[model samples]
Target: MKSITVRQLADQFQLEVLVGEEQLQREVTKARAHRPGLEFVGYFEFFPTEHVQILGKKEINYLHALTDLERNLHIGNIVKYHPPCFIVTSDQSGLKYLKRYCEEEGIPLLRTKLRTTPFIGALDAYLLKVLAPEISIHGVCLNVSGIGVLLRGKSGIGKSETAHTLIRRGHRLVADDVVVLKKLSEQTLLGTHNEVTKEFLALRSVGLVNVVRLYGRKAFQDETRIVLDIELTKWRENELNNELELEPKFVKYMDVSIPHIEIQLQPGRDVAGLIEAAANNWYLKQQGYSAAEEFMKRLEF
Candidate 1:
């Protein structure tokens, strides 16, 4: 199983470490955080020790309401299980109950100023991306007119060149040359560039191009959901277009079949414009409008 160090989670959210400083290096195996409400009230039937524990306002207040002996007993039940860490949300100050035990047991006790709901949401988002199934492919993913378009084809088939043109035309580049795609859901894929080369774009003749230096931040977006897949095929006179239909077709990647389009390429063809048009057409179809369907209705009339 993939895991991230507790220190990574603390650093990402700017969480303050209250105790167990040395244990920050310990790995967090689960992506989800657990809030043990019933456990505090003396129910430990289905204790989830696998996930990190979070304490919100309600749980902290309940512990404070209990007598010293009761509080100690309730906290003991939680500490004995060896949870990865304890995160106190909303900066609740009364949870001095957790610090001593967490320190003695070497479990990280962290505090965040963010409210419990937003903090858990952000933590879950980050953890899901880090722990999710991922694949790297040779393609360029861009945001064209608010649509996530992934350009994929054989090497030297002008994927980068087409992406370069799209960037010049004010479309944001999510990833170029190599795209890291993470499956966020069964139907959704998140596309992004590698951390080391996120700001660089590659070209055949000129080598590496710094997109940030040339186009600045406006031309770059961190990541996008890959909603459309366009495959650039070398133009063959006799080839037929099979994927073009009123009913949408898809290109499969790790069980995610995104709406797919195949564009035949020849020298001097306006490939970038065609890509933009395809995105717009797909967007139109999504909103219950199709040019093909309208044309067929005209033929019937």
Candidate 2:
């Protein structure tokens, strides 16, 4: 499982370290933050140990209301559970006993100046992005007419060459050779280039080339939401030619299905132009305009 360390979170949010200096390397496995309100009141059965414990103003006020013995008992139970870390929000700084306890137990305790709600929201977003399910695809991803199109095919089938042609024609390339796809949410897949291969494309004979440097920054995009999946296949003599009325196809990745299309590869064919047209056609279909349906309507009329 992918996990983020306390030190990384502290550096990202500029959290102040109040105690547990040696626990900076503790790993946070969960994306959700936990509020220890109930735990502070001696409800220990349901306390989440994997989540980062967040103490807001209300919880702190409740803590301050308790006698030293009561507070020690409550905090001691929490410390015994060994949570990933603790965060006090809103810059409140009157928890000397809690800080001392955390220091003694070697549990990382941090404080942030952000309000409780916004801090929780931001942390949730960051964790979601970092911990989201990811997969690598052997294809090229591009933004064509605002639609993220992923081109897939066997080696030497001109996927990269087609992407290069599309780039030259003003479309932006998200990734070439290998596209790293991350499921940002249930229905959304975000595609990005592998770090070592960012902005670089490998051609058959021309070798490695930097698309961003050659065509400027406009030719490359950092990431794009994949909406369409297209596969290129070698042209066959007896292949069906129902070009106007193609059935809807979908390709599933990471439990999400995206619209899919297949294009035949042949000599003297404008594959790049066809891809651009396919992207625009997909956009039109999204707007409730289907050329194939319109043609079928005309035929029936």
**Each prediction's Cα lDDT score?**
0.89, 0.91
Residues 158-237 of candidate 1 have per-residue lDDT tens digits of 89889889999999988888899998889889999888779788899989988878998989999999999999999999
lDDT of 1 at 181: 93
Q: Which model scores highest in lDDT? A: 2
Cα lDDT tens digits, model 2, 1-301, are: 8898999999999999999878899999888899998888778788789999999999898889989999899899888889989999999978999998898888999999999999999999899878878999899999997889999999899999999999999999899888999888889998888888899988889999999899999999888999999999999888857677678899999998999988898899999999999899889988999888888899997
Among all windows of 10 consecutive residues in model 2, the one with the lowest summed lDDT is 238-247
- Mark the regions of model 2 whose C-alpha exceeds 4 Å error after superposition: 41-46, 65-70, 287-289, 294-301
lDDT of 1: 0.89
